[model samples]
Target: MAKDYQGEEILVVRRSLFDELGEFQGINADVDAYLPSLLNPENNFFMDRGAAEDDPSHKQLIPYCIFRVKDDQGTRYLHYTRGKSGGESRLHAQVSIGIGGHINPVDQREDHLGFDTYMAGVEREIDEELNIEGGHTNKIVALLNDDSNTVGQVHLGVVHMIDLENDDVAANEDAIANLAFTTLEELRGELYDRLETWTRCCVDVIEEL
Candidate 1:
């Protein structure tokens, strides 16, 4: 079943054993294992038709993206949150990439016009998270989709560095605790250990950029 995400909650899903094992073998194996399942025509995961009537698990998966911004001084800033998820209470701020949530049925129809459905979701997510008005000016470096790591398929929309200094962008308090720009070294040394898969993917994408 699709999980409900209240404005107050943050969901972090993990990769499957197949994903973890494939990481050591090669990227292709990992990609093949996860991607085909999602893109297969026989599978209802990517189809827009009303297969929900036949298969109860036919609900569309939520699509999301991650953004990595850098400043003139070469300091990279990632969006993050810090708080208690359950019984654990630690005053730690998790540094992660910036992006936003799923493409709702309404968003799929109205917000994204010319782009691919998934690309549209990425564009919408960036706009919603950063309060930006249009597609990112930076070049899209990579498009990654990994379902093994999440309950819903995760699409990593990697873009070239963005200059957030002049922009009026700020984190939504209800969704995050604090958002700041930190160095890559800091992210790897201090924050990576505590990060979720989505956050780890952001770091990986940024390193390639």
Candidate 2:
């Protein structure tokens, strides 16, 4: 059975605006080229999630954060398996490198939606999912899109690469299981086939990011 998401509002921008800015298949590392206009108060707003879920006219803005750290060996990224309890049922059981969620009305500031408001939601979403004992800096590295599937059709991803001071992180939700940090080579090797579509997209061009 499908979960009832009535009354839930998520941040979204018109698909027309996305096309106007320039749309691509996978990851586009040109963030500065589109973020300003995309997050402008006049360009985006909150909408009923149930209605937005299937509507291709709107694209939900998701902050997909990738946590990474450089240790003795090499660079490693935080990864996990999506448990059934996750909100996106289609991605359950798949391995994911990113950690984030939907932006809601709570992220809005006094009826205004901008980069600050968008980032507030990003921080909140990450906090709700994980516990980080170390410091980190978040940088918006790219924008992700995938029109080949139902889930991807209605959602857009803003990829953030978070550079962690250390690998002291733990999952706070059951949705994130088997949490661990691994090298890029490992992710591209044995784990490549098990990765979710978005993660696979990010992995394919992560070096540039």
| Top-TM-score structure, candidate number | 2
Query: Could you give me the TM-score of model 2 versus the true structure?
Result: 0.97
Per-prediction TM-score, please? Answer: 0.53, 0.97
Q: Across residues 36-72, which tens digit of lDDT does each residue of candidate 2 receive?
A: 9989999998999988988999999999999999989
lDDT of 2: 0.94
RMSD of each: 7.9, 1.0
What value does the lDDT take at residue 170 in candidate 2?
Answer: 94
**Model 1, 1-209: lDDT tens per residue?**
43233332211112342244242311121333543343333332223222221232333333434444444657566556753441112223554454554434343433232235445655565655556433444444433444453322423222334544443456543455566667778777777887655456656656554
TM-score of 1: 0.53
Candidate 1 segments exceeding 4 Å error: 1-70, 82-94, 109-120, 132-138, 145-168
How much is 165 displaced in model 1, in angstroms?
6.1
